[model samples]
Target: MFTDKLREGSTGPVAKFLFIIIMVSFAIAGVGSYLTPKMDFNPVKVNGNSITNGELEQQFRLEKNKLERQLGKAFREQAKDPAFNASLRKQTLERMITDQVVSDHIFNSGVVISDDLVKNRIREMPEFQVNGKFSDAQFRKVLSLAGYPSPLVFSEALKGDISKEIYLKTAFDSGFALPDDVAVMAQILSQERTFSKIDIAIDAYKKNQTAGEDEIKAYYDSHSKDFLLPEKVKVSYIYITAGDFVNDVKYTDEDLKKFFDLHAELYTIPEKRTVSHILITGEDAEDKIAKVAEELKGGASFEDLAKKYSEDSSSKDKGGKLPAFAQGVMDSSFEKAAFALEKTGDVSEPVSTQFGWHLIRLDGIEPGHGADFNQVKDDVIEQYTKVQSRELFMDKKQIIADTSFENPDSLDAAALAANAAREEGGQVSKSVQIKTSDFIANGDEKAAFPLNQPEVQKVMFQSELRESPVNSDVVELGDNAIVVVHVEGYQEPAPKPLSEVHDQVRDAVLTAKAENASGATLKSVTDSLAKSESLEKYVKDGLIVISGPATISRIKTGDVDAQVASNVFAMPTPEPGNITYKSFAGNNGSSYVLVLSKVVDPKLGADSARDSFLNNQIYNFRYGEDNQIVINSARAESKVEYNENREYLKMQEEQNN
Candidate 1:
């Protein structure tokens, strides 16, 4: 079990801030710095083999950018907070590290995915198919569109992904068990005991305790390091969106026609036909359907009769009208009959189907036609113009980045270069402060200040403020544009003084002291319960004893806390006087103490369902345990190095004073 331990009450606002700072600092450092002098940008160095930094960064950025785009401006803005970004980076790095570890282990274990398997998997992919069969053209087109150099490389990457998935599955497969084992386990798990439990309420203990100012101050002085705040910055930024470009571009008739001529397939409409049906439901309804078919053949009104009896609510109200449908949209028998009709207003005989009987009418037909240039002109012009504008933006941004780097002193020179790249008659927007911080923080979302986006954020954070005044590399923003960001400002985090948060420190100390006292009280109660043996005696003596054995699984049971359940399962089997302890934080400055009775293991041959249940249980346990072993081994083998810069730590110490 990957149990997440809750932080103790010693955590204060200042301590939390420091934690965030350290996490963020580490995250930034992970991406920006190498783990060891001998190691390059690789996240993992396994027995001299490395997973390069470039590969990890590329994958991370691609995934990050894809998410930013999908979430749009609102969600991107929410994700843009420095603290959020820092957390995201940490999560990403941790995942990368974990993946690298797993990958290294897999390789060392000699697990391999064959080329034949890769090919078979690719064939199974729906995207590489047309008409339910794999198409080489489609496969190549998709691979090209995705920027994969070749099918072999793409297949190899997929193989690696598949191998990792298989590895994990093999590791975690233990959690499931056979039905027989489950039945036996359930019986043992559900077996009721008459014993009662005396919970030493932490809240009661806390209410009895009182802390003086001197005691609180003394606690604070001893644990002052827990009260120091980390450095933080407040920033304001603005961002210009790519969608804004849609409003500025104009579509001319000639441009539209040209676009349509170049991409005619996009505007072609597929053949479609309107259909209607009347269903008769029951056993042997086919005989009744044939009689209706005969009546239709005799020219009985299809619409009037359908209205009186049609079971399909969608078409019944609209005179049995169904909107135009193409192949595969309707049932096979219905579709075959509907499409076989030679002309509009054709009616089919009552047909036998899973729905019983169907009297289908073909109301209208729309023949497939290649759209005329004039008909699709506007759409073509919009698409082509946007594509052109995007290219133009990239070209202009590149010139600005290059020229600015070459001539570090003149902002005018960069602007002129940018303006020069634009087409004649095209108006240029005001010069925006393009900084890497803006792109990093805002992603694709509009920023409060233009320079705070990720593209800008990267440059601002990476470039030396004094030495590298301008960044020359073109920062690509999706497939739309590439923009260069210039560093405008720099701010370093500073620690806050102890006097600023003395009261907060005092409160934290009090809470910690209370928790300690409560823990001690809980231990005493549990010890007493063990000595007494009968929980009924404790209840009679005034303590409340809550009695009931709970049914639970590894997958959380809603009634009990997950941590509590985990701890309970870890205890030894029931024997009189045996006691186990578990604690959890509670609401309103309170805590919970759980006194556990020994678990009763099920008899192996107790149930007829034991075999199946045991199988599943064995599988689940083996998988979970093996996975943990793999993870632990990987962690132990990998190396992690933190930055030596103690400026933040020093500030924290000063603040504590």
Candidate 2:
């Protein structure tokens, strides 16, 4: 706690921001005033300040966007929870309320936010920075998206946020954790749970209890919809894919020969040449060339002359070297001159191309060889497949669709006519679940087309069930695969009969009774243990007793069940000399009775290993609670009142709906 960076007399803006963050566990920014104008039709009021409905909705939407970004695709699942959505709305509204509360406190407390500070804060914001400087364009673009139409309008909100930060900074800076309180908290946080647990597994009672026929019937009568299936279909589909006929459509030697004859260019490997170059072309090119030729005739080495006088940036070092090249990679004149050389060590006179003059040398030559049928059999087969498939895919696809739509019956006839059809059957529910396989071939999840795609589920579940399963129009999985679904069987949602769901009902009845029995058993055991102070008898009676991990000082115990840990902490600390005991329900369909025989305070050195007293954890926690008290005081002093306009209630109702 004493080693925290946010200490007294720190003047850095960054440090100041951290202090405020620690204040209320909230990032409150800006100070002084509300941004929108007060009006008679205001929907919400905080600290006597009226906030317009439009402003509330705008803030709500901004918060909603942030939540969606955090949630990603999971937001779709969360949206289904009314409680979560309600909490989301409540938190957003509460944020607006908190803003007003904090703003009032800031103004009364004499906290100030200046234009320069606001501008500096904006410029430092990563969203508005381009190439490490504040970009006006980026700032405006962000504002436009955020529904802040003008820089002026956004400045007000920014100013308000800064004011709140200042108010919190003052409050947090004044907070102090007393030495005695720190000792007690540290001891509690570092205490370990040295106790053993007795688990009452639900399975143990299964043999002793059974849901009789009448009980099963009675349970089913009351909870019929529990067994009612969402909507299911038995589908028989014929999948037509390139994979289906890749092996069947074989390429023979004769076929390969014909294919080779048509696309023979692709098989021909062009001749390659190994070459090197040097160039001398500047102001005195003609004069320099004659001197170079004279020096070459006088036995001056070509490499030496090139190194001393060549102007070419490339190949100037390492005595001029170039990679071997094919004909088309170089300029025509250069290619011709280089290829014209009969042997290695041949040199050509300086020749000009687009990149200035060049002194060409032929280091080596490699003759080109055209691949025969035996050398490229795989290529021939692949080319043949691609060519054939391209020419035939459209026709095959259309014919499959036409036949299935026209007949609405046999997939057998369609299979005879297209790429090839393979029969597949499965049950589908309301969504994309198709009983799938882990097996994959060539990186493809080998689900026959219909069940693999969710789009088909949307179609099939919406379509009326047929008595005699028949094919529907083709549903294309992708460009390469297509299939037609036959609704062979279906079961509509209904109250399931006791005979049909007898086993399920029996299990449910048993589980429910087991849970109740476990709860009752737990109460009885805990009562007996507290009175008798002995767990040995219960431990002997098939209650699997195991010692739990050291957890009091532990902040993160991922291996332990969260519910069990929470219940354990919620257990009262043992009376001065006596141990404490409690009962908790386990998520594994079991009951647990935990005994806390001791509170093991952590052993520490001057340079502590434990974190309870480090990082200002206790001080920060107390500050947040104290900061809330200050905010409440400010809000209560304001004498706030709500207009409760009809339109405001209607707006909220519509939003909830």
- What is candidate 2's lDDT per residue for 1-657, written digit by digit as tens? 665554644778887786777664433533312344443666667755677767776776676666665676797456544345546666777777777777777787888788999988887665564323566976775666555658987888899878876767666663555655666665666667655577875665565577788888888888988877455666666655544444444456898899988776567675678876777664457677777777877888778877887776677775667888765467866776777677789888777765556777778777766788878888988888877654455566676677766676666555554534323442211111113223212112244444644545544554543554466655554334555666666656666666888888999988887777667667767788779656566566654455664455456545666676677777777866677877665666576778876766676444332332443566677667767887788777765566666655544533441
Question: How many residue pairs clash in each candidate at the backbone level?
Answer: 53, 10
- Candidate 2: where are CA atoms >4 Å away? 1-94, 104-148, 169-186, 228-493, 512-520, 531-552, 556-558, 572-578, 587-590, 608-615, 630-657
Among all windows of 10 consecutive residues in model 1, the one with the lowest summed lDDT is 648-657
Give each model a TM-score.
0.51, 0.44
- Best lDDT among the predictions, by candidate number: 2
lDDT against the true structure, each candidate: 0.58, 0.64
| Model 1 root-mean-square deviation | 16.5
